[model samples]
Target: MSSIRGARVAALSAVVVAAFALSACSGGATDDPPASAEQTLRLSAQAPPSSWAIGNAPGGDATMYLSVYDTLLRTTPDAEITEGLAEEWEYNDDLTELTLHLREGQEFTDGEPVDADAVVASLNVSREGPSTATNLTAVSDVTATDESTVVLTLSQPDAALLPNLADVAGAIGAPDVLTAESSTLEPVGSGPYILDSSSVAGSNYVLKKNPDNWDADSFPFETVQFQIIADPTAITNAMQAGQLDWIALNTPDQLAQFPEPKYTSGSNNANGLGVLWLADREGTIVPALKDVRVRQAINLAIDRESIAEKLQVGSLHPTEQVVNPNGGAWSDELNETYSYNLEEAKALMAEAGYADGFAVTMPSTFLSTPYEPTFSQQLGDIGIQVTWETVPFQDFLTKVFSQNYGMYFMFNAFRSADSVDVRGATTAIFNPFNSTSPEYEALIAEANSSESADAFAPVNEYFVKEAWFAPIFYTAGPWVASDKVTYTPAKTFYPSLKPWAPAN
Candidate 1:
């Protein structure tokens, strides 16, 4: 139920205002007094850093890379595929290779023709590049067969090939523009927007319209500024001050403040899975998490209904499956069987030898704070005393990934709607038989190798019913535009909302 909005929302909103101003100047304002269509959209965020370059680079930031750049394909909330840089593609009978036909005439801001070579170059960069999504290393090779045709060969028959390409790692940019250092701050891509600047500490990113875009006529906004505001109250206040067009409200309390059309609710196909990591480290709580019983007890004690109501602000529905309700070929199996039950949780704790109780501290960040209360409440109901410590996301990433924190929340968005598409990465997390799970690895492996979607249904059922992960809710953040801005409705999140043209 915790409402949250991303800082990128404010950045795009600013660009939307700027584009409006340009529109007014282009058209004569008549007797109503010549008002310059030139709009200087100002956006405010609670504590967003001023600079962050998110891309194929090592220090890449997520919000910058996704919000300002474009992807090869897009997936809808229902897991359907839509055109991105590639207008269409076809796979061989074996599903081992895919040939994509790039859209004609699409070019980077630098005017480099978006051709087969460009596609190969983009993929190669990520395949061997330092990126959050380094899994592309699994790609065998990329061959440019013709001007617009590029064929991709993977190590295995990846049914989720196209959908995976929709990820940020697949952002298509110019070959020449990419350099070891340039990636840190400079971004050159075929998306509607271009990177203008990045904050000193790599916290925020600024973007502008790509005038040379093949669809420039449809590209609306002129400029955008994304700040690293991570605080919910500050995000809400910014909206009230007209400093933001749209933001991802992070908590239920934050959502209640909005009246109606001004702020709306939508389901994001992505979901966050609760993780109680067990790796040992200093000043950490993992030593206790190593016990499977403890992990199970925590999952059982969660009150999904209360959390959804308090934080969702009536915008979302609780989820059981890792996939969203609108999930595609992979999520037809999700239902309400995973309800909350405090009694079962207590029993699990007792079985774990903690009949009295255990005290634990959860390391969390801005994105996870709103959910902390709900987590704490549920644990308390089961005789567990929980204290949550708030940490910055950047710091947490640097610290927690190394086992610095025992328990935390992990977020995974569906790279594609296809079941095969999601299974690849998700398998890495839940696979219990991997060296990480030595004992229960079969549970995760079965779900991953199952040839038929139906065959994997049982394994998938176990993960959901066992409460291995406490599911929250799915939410699609609303993109509220100033009526003056005009845009093409995109099925995915990559298309810049600000580049939308201004009303004449």
Candidate 2:
């Protein structure tokens, strides 16, 4: 099975290379300038869609969804919520109900009107979809109250609802296309670009400008092509050869390869928590990890600053909390508590009755994280033995989401606009590690009910004090683009086309 998957991936890469070559010569007239002079932009990305269905793809595939469909609301890199399909929205005084007013005279590419009914239909479909189920867990009902008004009623007050709506979960598809069985292959949306079916999935994708789109003027490119080149070396080679206009720099080393005069580069802090998972707090996997002191000891043992400076080479910011620095829940007091002290860690380990230390197993992935070696070494110094279990990327994701690991390290980007968004991020990632403690449950409930950052601060402080998960850092990477196009990288983990424009 592994070999078969590898063969498919290799074939896909070859197809992308071929399609990219073909795109340069196919579209223009003989008198037209060279392919590089055309308004079309070419991008090389790591993941292409396995399934184009909105609900079937992972939440991280927001860029792909946004390319074809527009959400009810849009979130900026700074986490601000702005209008998308819906022109305006407001929550009722009690906050259990949200009312949205649709933009006037909008239509999907299929020529169906985008109104209250359309919004309700899309929301209903998303609520039942696997990728979006968690985001809409609180939503009880969606109703089209009138031609232009749609009301969403929640079982309880949830601060993250609006922000989640700004993500891929809230993407609105055309009713006609959505109801059809071929919806996955032929998506119809009201966004600035329409997906061209001529391109193959998982290899290459072509998006033609939607001239009839309401926000047509907002999009500067006439065409956008995405080539799924999984190999990092191939992506760099393609960029240098001028076959690709934009590429994301996964490492700081790639920064030097794209120099000035010919290319432009930009970066922003990624919107997620880089977490050290000390899962199995209930003693399901490692008996020693059940104690809160043990978790705190592990947190104090690792030198996060050194790892960021040496391994990451300043590409990431060492973070003690899961919330973004600008978020309302971020606390200077809490961040100060995470100073690395070996003696303190040793003392905590003794207090937790593990002075001799205990052994724990962790799964290893193909992608090497800076935390792995440092975590193992520091924990070993404090008498903890770590046994590594090597696994593929798919198996790793399955285990992490299934809560089958004792210890693991990974990062998650939370699309946060405020303190309420901080709480939302907490719920989305940390809920799986939750225990049956009444105090913890009460804190979570209060955080969920909060409407502002001030109300959510205590919950954020509580998680930090408990040392639930050790946050390593906030990551940011470079987006290298050619001099012909002007682009501003979104403060997100993924690249987006919405912020791109022609250079002046």
- Scored by lDDT, the top model is 2
> How big is the positional error of residue 19 in model 2, measured in Å on the Cα after superposition?
24
Every candidate's lDDT? 0.49, 0.65
Compared with the true structure, what per-residue lDDT tens digits does model 2 show for residues 236-348? Answer: 79989998876655456767888998998765444434567666678776788789999999889878888777765545667788765666777878887878988999999
Question: How does model 2 fare in lDDT?
Answer: 0.65
What is the TM-score (0 to 1) of candidate 1? Answer: 0.71
**Deviation in angstroms for 308 in model 2?**
1.1
Cα lDDT tens digits for candidate 1, 414-470:
233334323532443232222233323465454333446454455456555544455
Worst 10 residues of 2 by lDDT: 20-29
Q: Which stretches in model 2 have alpha-carbon errors above 4 Å?
A: 1-38, 177-181, 251-253, 368-371, 418-437, 448-450, 453-455, 490-496
The CA lDDT at 301 in model 1 is 70
